[model samples]
Target: MDELDAWFPYETYRPYQREMLELAATCARNGGIAMIDAPTGSGKSSIVSALLAERAGKKVIVAVRTISQLTTFIRELELVRSRKRTLAYSYLIGKRSLCPLSGGGDVYRRCEGVKAVSTSLMRERAGTGQLVPSRDPVIIRQMKKLDTQHPIICPYFIKSRVFTGGDGNALRMLPSTTLRNRADRITRERVLPHELREMGAGICPYEMLLLAAQKSDVVVVNYHHLFDDEIRTQLYGSLGIEPHEVHLLIDEAHNCGEVMQGVMNTAISGPALLQAEREILGLRRQLKQAVAVTQIIRNIGDFMEGLRNSHEAEDWFDPSIFDRIVVRGSLYRDLSEVVDDLMQISEHIREKNRAAGEYATTAVEVLTAFMVRLTCSAPDPAFLTVFRRDGDEIVLEVRNIDPSGRLQELARSHHCCILISGTLSPIESFRRYYFGELDVMTKTLPNIFPPSNRMVLCAGDITTAFSMRQNRENTDRIARYITTFASLAGNLAVYFPSYQILETYAGILEGRLSSRNLIVEPKDARDAGDLLKTFLSLPARGSSGILFAVCGGKWSEGLDYRGDLLAGAMVVGLPLAPFNRVRQMTIDYYRHKFGSDGEFISYTLPALNRAEQAIGRVLRAPEDRGMLVFGEKRFLEPRVRSGLPSWIRDEMAECSIDSFAAAVKKWK
Candidate 1:
């Protein structure tokens, strides 16, 4: 057996697994960045084993995009632990999932408030000679005296700790035996976030997992744990580790840009501004600049109101107009002064609310954050000021168009950074888009499964081009294509460019395909869970279902439609974002950044990535067989076709509706 097999966990390696492992090992050995586009079922999770083998005492952090992905790594590590019985690993999820407190508010803020109260009460008890507050009758009685409406005492947190030494100058706190044992079990066994919560019935699950993570050689966490600046700082501090001591593995990394942008983006809505005004009035007695800040908010609201006449659902809003309005309507000379004053005011309001046991986010805080980003955006070309109409309200956003600068910084700060995904094909484009001139290794692995197990087809007769979408002939052709694809026997999904398009196609296909159950993706997320659950269960009952969903929507990415759950997937059109002034600005920015290929990199590449994610759902494993169809003719175009994975491009058969029907019959 090879020396690295000590970390490999499995009895045997899959095809090309050793190659991807070597890529990860090289990344670890050289302390550089590597991007690997390994198709699904390539056992990409095993990359963690390579990182572990190459970790010369440095810790490995696996950042996943979803719970299922996290569980995959957890299971992989469990297998590793069976071989290396001394292996120590743990995982961290958001406190929202592990917190036992039942309430409706920002989980972080609520956690902070309760921790503050818990610490204060414990310290008070310690001063009174009751060092073991978790066991103190007096402290328990004191906790009971608190108002029931707003829970200030977090019993789990109190139970998770125990003080050591004297209560005065030599005071210290350590994890209780129960907490330590629970956390140790987490490191020894495969404990998911939910299981950790169950194990921590009396102790704090987050605290237990955090303790486990501190001693762990490997830690699994969500993207925000490392991508969001504040969260990363806090998490690293809590774990007592520096970025240089960590080797990073980002799973499903195709979504990294979007997730990083989410962390960098800031927005303030009209209702939020109105609420800020109300908050200012309520705290007018305490805020010395309350009057000025209130007027500035109204001016900002008026600025948004003025743009409501544009008749466009979304558009770019010149930041200069905002500056003019704030200066002209308020006593502030510039945005810096306005933002500084708002920051102090928002801080004061937050502190007051915390004191009152109300930890929910206030609008003043949102306004302050937005203004800070707006002021900062003046010097940052990557940031854009945009507005969109949400019913009767106008929401302003400071959107970050490029997540590379931050991602690059993060990559350079780590011991080694490895990004892996199934759809990060055209690896050179992603390398340029993500790292610019930063020297990084790129690897693209072929489909390890047999080519005959899946069939990829692209239509040559239809397009959802902007000009052609309104054409009745085009609409009729798309409906006919969808209905034809629906003729398959098992679960299938047809992804459209937008919900509007999905609804239009749904309307056209109504009462046309009655044999298959139709499941339309909801506009809101409330019902998405139930919708997906219902869709997945259909195949087991020997029923066929067709899911009409939008590309890049909830159902498109970050999901596995394994085996019979999804027999075929058809992408209706290129999922290009609707063109607007903001999009144009983004294209212009990228064009300037990437030169001739800027438009393709910034605009076309993302759309194609979405379509790839949609159609790539078929054939999750080596034995899983399914059909893949690209409904748009653009997929046949050289530029777009070249951007897709080599496996699909090589196996794809171009066909029209009649030809597709013939292929479908043969496929069955």
Candidate 2:
């Protein structure tokens, strides 16, 4: 294999790349589900890509959390293709974003009038230098005919006319016809790869997965597309297939439970309901002119009053109970009638304001749908939340709880599923929530970085109780510690739990550390980047300064500040989220679901994951040297410390921070 490796661009695998790939291959062969817990820079991409390349006949779908990650994976795949000269791939974006023109479809006829006028202008310029506008009804009719069928395609010719200053020269410039001819020839050959087929080009990746499941071997998408109820229904409903037909690979599987809960939970607040009532009332005022609007407004008012009354009875109304109040019989009968009334009035308003056009209709439809969905009874959890903003107006928000079951059902129907991520630890929790009865294979790869090179420190006394923002004495102590620490370190990044804490600590250290370079996380992205750049570029004196940041924020993850760019990290707090009603309710919800100790599964564990993610930021490579400072005292607790990975525990036993200044002195 080493000798054959000359054919590849990269010579070696990173950490457990081969093992993960082997597992993936085994899973592929047996048609079983596999969950991989590989850390960042662990070459998970190569492992997955290898599996994809080997499995030519089987379509593999890769789903990630963000579009940016998807794009990155696509680029990595492209790089592999460049080296291996095997496998074919194409990007499938959301269906709404698919280009109708690119697919050789006649979906642009809606803009035929513009197309015709533009074409006429082009022709007139071709024959004569003067621009000519056409108003002939016959030409207009023909253009309208073309527009109705090929709106997206015909618009190019129209746009060409505009670009060419109403001259046909742009159209005459050719190449499109030649390209089309080439495409036609290619299509006839059938030798072109399945990925080259024009069939699934314009559909969303999720939709494309459904369409090409039997054909293409691999599909990639975000976590939301697979887990979100709306997207899941759309894909499954359109494909008419069960989830079991597809293999499951959940990348970033650690966040699966959180994503599942997020999709499943729905909340509506009192203030938002009140605002909706006002808006409905405003529409009702137009009732003298539009009876439909008036009737719809009255119905909305009734619904709002019922919602308020339900809330008044209890602080929280279970979605099931609320549904019993709103939805009756079939067709969402109550809300459906309101939708009909609103739709009628909206149409009238649209006609009256032709300039307003689709916007008016769209708004009406959105509101109508909202009302209908609000009133419809579903098995999902729903909550009514109230928020008070300034200016005397209260906001109400309504949301559904736990859409994960629906998503999982959809995934099972599809067959093969893959969930991948760096942070999925204590994998059982995620599996219990996401896969449930579905059998799943799990693997956790060792940290990609060599454990010996990086030093992890856990300060025993750093607690939120002693946090600077919460206590002035603690602020002074932290500042003194940081100043002394900077005297020894070349470069450092100190992470705070929140912006308030960062600001408070930075204020304490203001004038004392003038000689030392300092960078603070700005409130905005561009500013933050700028600060990081300044810090990175600063001359590396034997003892440099600090970069202050917030934990679990943009700078903490998705950043590489290795070597001298970052020498030490002062983690001020455990990153436990502040106490809030919603968080309390979330804790209660989990407690009810999984017993009293379930709060650990629901809240505490996730918070610890975030702290772990922050710690991960400092150690980019095995050769990097960094000191991790945990300022929170609660982290010393047995329960909290137990949640940390084994490697972290081993490191903490060796390098513990007693006093901030003393800990700083020991960094080197």
Candidate 3:
């Protein structure tokens, strides 16, 4: 206990940190899924750190949804290793991030399997029995030094890439265990800063990590390592790791189902189909198979024409749609073969252009992948085929209507799994949708904050319903409430259901709250950095700034607005997703299949998840006091209230502005 405590950054554990650590350790030893709901400031990372440092039973793989999270998780790993003397660990990311030299050249992308791992090389490594990598520090240092000045495009293991492509009797790096087994071997240790920088000089980061993981106790990676089939097969097979030998920890795990859905789902845009036709024309000039390629191009034009003539509407159907498309005799098989041929040729073209050192194969590769996905079989009944119309063509979206099947597979594959997040509630629906029949252990940690530090209230008179929103009287009432609330909190933010609502209400409130600056969120998420920077730079002590952002959009989640940057919120209207045809059909499908609870699962819970996320932004810490006003009357309804976080559901009440102001003043 003392040894593990030394690895923890904090002097002592937070409220639930100890319990979380114990639970995670038990999950590591046993086998099943553990569903945990701990709030934002619950020291979730600290618990995960302690688990890895102390529990050395099974190999640990920490998977998260995004790169930012992977970076953060690795930082914690660094701290644990600092205390434990040394821990071998690395982040396995997409090859593109680590390769700056693969562009504008014939230098094939690092860690490439597109060409093929030479079979002769694998047999050579096997015959020699020189499995353990032990190149000197001098050689590594020289490469790192060279890379710092001029990076090279070193596509390492051009031959080793095939060891696990389909064969299993290949090289297995000797089943190296944790630190206890490899304590004296420095070459087998974790890759440090300069070494990683050296790899960016063109070494295959994927293969490097596979060697490192052989000696590592904990390996951190993006969820793609587990969910994306191509990456999973390449990485696990190369590491010689079986599913049951590993334990998985998923942070921000609410999005686990979404990750699997992304791997399973694929979309073909209107423009890509047009481009594929053009690429076929180019192939006609290069290859003898011009006639066959020309036919596929003609079929694409016909398909586009059919979509243009049809009504512009969205429809959700089942797998039967695939059979109907097959009957049309569109070149499903030929399209697949054409993509493979084009890819092989593109490699050569890229090589020929190596001297010019430029790359333009991104679009071509993306189009080929989309075509390939269209032919995949979705045997799962939960996969829904959605068709939506665009101008000259239609976009076909394949979405997995449920995540239970994949979640069950993931659970069975690992020694055990831990799924934790701040908003993992409505446990019944989450379990039903994500875990299905698996027995999932669920736990919720109460928010650790002084009750008086935050206030939750709803406006009984003001309703942002479509019917009442534009009424002159209701507009004036809404404007009056926002202006008054703005005066109470110095630095605040307001959220809307859409950019349209943001524009509508901000204009209406401008006349009343002219002193406050209204900085709106950018329409595109990528363009939000400067807007947020300007907003965060404003004085946080007064009502001088009010950023208008749409709920569930650019500024809603993943932003840290503790203490000054955020003091209160005006979440205007329920973010009830419009009853679009697809949405209604989805609700109807669930209602017909599973009943009323299914309807709630399909519709109501998602809306509240966003609403809860919006409200949670104001109170970042125990000492930071803030206020929230729900502008929609529907928020006070029983169904909506049930979906909110327990802390809000327990304390929130309908109150007039006068009473709310007095409560905030006296709360201290």
TM-score of 1: 0.98
Which wins on lDDT, candidate 1 or candidate 2?
A: 1
Candidate 2 versus truth, CA RMSD in Å, comes to: 9.2
Q: After superposition, how far is residue 617 of candidate 1 from its true place, in Å?
A: 1.6
Cα RMSD for candidates in order: 1.3, 9.2, 6.5
**What is candidate 3's lDDT per residue for 295-331, written digit by digit as tens?**
6545644554565655646666443544444334544
How does model 3 fare in lDDT?
0.65
List runs of model 1 lying over 4 Å from the truth.
167-169
lDDT of 1: 0.89
Ranking by TM-score: 1, 3, 2
**Range of the 10 consecutive residues with the lowest summed lDDT in candidate 2:** 102-111
> How many pairs of residues collide in each model?
0, 85, 4
Sort the candidates on lDDT, descending order. 1, 3, 2
TM-score of each: 0.98, 0.69, 0.79
Q: What's the true lDDT of residue 650 in model 1?
A: 91
Question: Which tens-of-lDDT digit does each residue in 278-373 have in candidate 2?
Answer: 544555556543444444444433544555433232233344443344444333444456556655655555444332111222344345445545
Query: Candidate 1, after superposition: displacement of residue 668 in Å?
Result: 1.5
